[model samples]
Target chain A: MTELRLMWRNTRMVVLCAISAALYAAVLVPFKVVPLIPGVTELRPANAIPIVCSFLFGPAAAWGSAIGNMIGDFFGGVSPGDLFGFFANLFYGFIPYKIWEIISRGEGPVIRSPWIAVKYFAACLAASVLCADFVGWGDNLLALRPFSLLGNVIIFNNMASAMLLSPFILAAVYPRVRRGRMLYEELMPEIKPAPMPRKTLGLALLVAGEVGAWITGNLLSTGYWTPGFLPAWMAAAPYDKSVAMIVSPFMLLAVVGLCLM
Target chain B: MKTTLYIERDSFVHRLHPTAKVFGLFVVFWSIYWVDNPLALMPLALIVLAIALMMGAWENVYRFRWFFILIIVPTMLTWMLFYRVGKPLITLPPFYVSEASLMFGFGRGLKVGALVLASVLFLSGTKVEELAVGLSRLGLPYRLGFTITLAFRLVPLFMESALTVVDAQRLRGYDFDAGGPFERIRRYVPVVVPVFMGALRKANNMAMALEARGFGRTHRPTSFIEYRMHPRDAAAFAFLLALGAVSFWIYYSGLGAIPTG
Candidate 1:
C-alpha cells in the first residue's frame, strides 16, 4: 500500500504505470466487439494484462489496472458505478502480486511447478473474488444491478483470463523484464515486506472477507437467504439496503486486511 | 485505431471549462442515481439528447448504438427475472412479468442507458487533456493526472503496435479465428508477447527521458494550457446544481421510484 503512494515519486514507476495502463486499454478497446454478456461486460482477454502487469510492475500495475478500466469504460460508456469499478480493478491488479508475495515466498509467477501453478490459481482467485465483491456490493448498493449478476460473471471473467492468458504472457516476458531491471522488486528495492505474522493474518482476513462477501452478496441478491434481523422494508427485492448492511462489513474486513498487509 | 470518443467541436458545451464539464458529468450521475422510474429518467435523457445534438456528437452515439440497445435490453430482461411483484400479467416459469415488474425493469434499463448516454455526451465534447485538467481541478493529484493523460496518449500507439504484430503473424499463416473460444484466446499469446516486449523495451528510455526533463521536481507543475473560469462556467455550475437538486427532490417526493403492489 505504501508502494502505491511512493511509486509516484519515481519517474520510472510513473512511466511504467502509463505503459501498463496503455497496454491494457490497447488490448481492451479492440476487444469491445466480443461481448460476453452483451453490454454489461465483454469477453475481456484484456483482463490478463492486469495480472501480468501486477507480477511485473506491482503498485504501478494497480494504478494501471484502474486507469485502463476507466479508459475502457470511457469508450463504451461510463456511469457512477464505474467509480467502484475503478477501485475494484485497482484491487484486481494489486492483490495478485501482493498475495503472490505472501503465498509464493520466493517463487516467481512463471508457473514452473505444479505447486506454483496451484499457488498462481489461488492468487488469481483471491484477486478475482475481491474484485467481484467490490463491484457487486457497489452496484447493488446503488440499486444499479443485482449483486449476483455482476458478482458471479466478474469472477468467471477474471479467472478465465488470469488462468488462461496470464501464465504464458508472464512466462514470455517476466525473464526479460527481470533482466531489464524493470520488475517492481528490482526498480523499487526500497519497499520492504511486512512481517510474516502480520501478512499471514492479513491474508486470512482478506480471504475470509472476500469469500464471505461473495457468497453473502449472491444469496441476498438472488433472494435465496433473507436474514431474520433485517426489517421487512429492507428485505424486499432489489435488496440494495440489505446488501449494504450485510456485505459491507465483509468488504471492510478485506480492505483492513489489505492495509495490514 | 480511434482511441477516444471525443468529437472535434466548438459548441458551448465544448467551450465550457474542464472542471465545469467534469462537474456536469458528476451532477448527471448523481441525478440519475436517485431516480428509478423511466418517466422520471426521461427528462435527463432528453437533456443529454439535446446536448448531443447541439454538440453534433451523433457520430459517437451512432457508433455505440448497439451498445446502448444491448445495455437497456439485457438489463430489462434480467431485472424482470428478479423483480417479482404485483398482479402477474404473464408468468413464464421462473420469470413473472407484471406491471410492477415491467415498470421496474424498464426504469432500471433507462437509468443505465441514461447514465451511459450522459457519459457519451461528456466524452464527445471533452478532450483527454481537458478531462485530466478537469479532474485535477477537482482535486486529483498532479502525478495521477499526468499518468492518466500519458496513458491516454499511449493507448493508440500500443494498439497500432499490436495490429502490426497481428499483421506479421497473419502473414506467417497463423490462424487466429480458426479455433474454439479458449484456443482462439490462446492464439492471442503470440500477438500479446511481442507488443508487450516492445512496450517494456521503451519503459527504461521513457523513464530516463522523464527524469531528464525534471518531471517530479515540483509538486505543482505549471501547465502549458491554462483554463480560466468564465461567467458561463458559473452558469453551468448553477445549472448542474439545479439538476442534482431536482433529481434528489424527485426521490424525496417519491416520484422517481417504481410503483409496487
Candidate 2:
C-alpha cells in the first residue's frame, strides 16, 4: 500500500512509470516479427525490459509494463490476449522487485559472485512461472486453448529469453545506476525492512503450492502421468482435482498464516 | 520525434470518439474468438478489413504486408500440423496435417489478420491526446492518464537514444554482428548498458523539470482538453453493444460451430 501511495505522492515516480512503459513498448513493437510460437507467443527479448525495469524503478514498473503491453499489442497483431497479457505483464514487471526484497535479505542488488547470480536466477524463474501460469489459464478461458501448451511455451520463452539476457544487462547497468543514485533503493528511501519469519514461511508455502498446482494441472490436462506415478491413496482421485484440493489448503494456510503474523 | 501511430485522414473512423473506437475494438476482439467455423470467421475478417480500407488505412496495411504474410502463414501451418483434431491428410513420420485442420488454421489466421487490421485502424485514427482524454473520462485518474500519454510521447525519443547508443558502440570497434549468436548478444552489452544509464540520467532531469513546474502541488490538475460524446459516437457505441450481445448469443448457442460430419 505504501508503494501505491508513494506513486501518487512522489511526482517523480510517475515520470519513471512513463519512461518504463515507453522503453518496454519500444523494445516490444519492433520485435513483433520474431514469433517463436506464432499466434501464441513470440521471441521477446522485450521480456528483459520488465525484469530490468522492476529492479531499477520498483512498483511503477508494474503499471508501466501493463499499459505498455496494451499499446504494444496494437502494433503486434492485436488480440484479446491483452486481457491476460496486461496482468501477466504486471506480474512480469512487479514480481522481481517484490521478490527481491525477500530474496536479497536487506541487501541491494550485486552480482560480483556466483551465489548472488543464483538468487537473481531463482527470482526470475519464480516470476516466469507465476506469469506463465496465469496467462495459460486465461488463454484457456478466452481462446479455448488447452493449458499445457501455452503454459510450457510461455515459461520457456520468457524464462529463457529474459534470464539469458537480464543478468548481463543487470550486471552492466547496476553499477552505473548505483553511481547515478537513481536505483529504486536510492529513489525510494522508505524501503521495507526484512520480512518476519512467519511471513517468509507463508510466502514459501504459497509459492510452492502455486508451482505444484501449475505442474499437476498441466500433467493431468495433458494425460501424461500414470497411476503408478501417484500413491495408492491418491491414485483413484483424478489428478487435477486431487492436486487442486491438496495444494489449495496450503494457499489458504498461507493467507491465514500471513494475517496472523 | 516520430512517436504517434495516427495518420492524417478524413474518414468516418477518424472522426469517432476514442472511447467509442475502443469499445468497437472490444466488440470485434471478443466476437472473433467466439466464432468457431472457418466459413463464419471469414465474414468477420472481411468486416474489419473493409472498415480499415474505408478509413484509408490501405497504405498502412501495405506497409505491414510482409509482416502479415510471415505471421499468418506459420500460424496456419502450426495449427494444421499440431492442434486441430481429425484424420490425417498429409503425414510425415511424426506429424500429420489434416483437411479440417487446414481450414481451421486458415480461420484462425483470418482472426489474427482481422485483429491486426482493427488495431491499425484504431491507432491510425486516434491521436495520443484524445486517447488520454478518453482514458481520463473513463474514470482513470488524470495523473495516471498523463503518464500513459507521456509514455507514448517518449517512445520515439527512447528509440532514437537506443540507436545512438548502438552507433556509438559500433564506432568503438565493437562488432555487433560479427560473432555467433551468444557472442553477438554479449557484444550488445556495451550498447544496452549505456542507453539504460542515459535513460536514468534523463529520468532524473525530467523529475527536476516536473518539480520546477509545480506538477504535484494540486491534487486535481486541470486539463486544457476534454472529450465529449457526440451523437455519432453514441450510435457507434450502441452498434458495438448490439454486436457484442449478438456475438455472445451465437457463441452460447454454438451457432458458429463447424460441422464435423
Separate DockQ for every predicted complex = 0.82, 0.36
Model 2 Cα lDDT, one tens digit per residue, B1-261: 345557899898888887887778778887877786767777777777788789888777787677677657765654554443567776763434666666666666666666677777778788878777766666778777788888888777777877787778778877666755444444555655666666767887898898898888886777686566799998898888887777778778887765432
Off by over 4 Å in 1: none
Cα RMSD to native, each candidate?
1.0, 4.8
Off by over 4 Å in 2: A1-5, A31-35, A38-42, A144-146, A190-194, A220-261, B1-4, B81-100, B217-220
**True-vs-predicted CA distance for residue B51, candidate 2, Å:** 0.9
Where's the lowest-lDDT run of ten residues in candidate 1 chain A? Answer: A30-39
Tens-digit lDDT string for candidate 2 (A1-261): 247446756777888888888888876665443456655567666677788888888878878888787767755556665677787777677767766777686665556678777888877777787677666555544433444666678778777656667778887877677787777667778856445675577457647744764775476435455346556435321233433444345434433432322
Q: TM-score of predicted model 1?
A: 0.99
Among residues 3 or more apart in sequence or in different chains, the pairs in candidate 2 whose N, CA or C atoms overlap within 3 Å are none
Interface RMSD of 1: 1.0
The window of 10 residues in a row where model 1 chain B has the poorest summed lDDT is B178-187
**Model 2 chain B worst lDDT window (10 residues):** B180-189
Query: For every model shown, what is its TM-score relative to the native structure?
Result: 0.99, 0.85
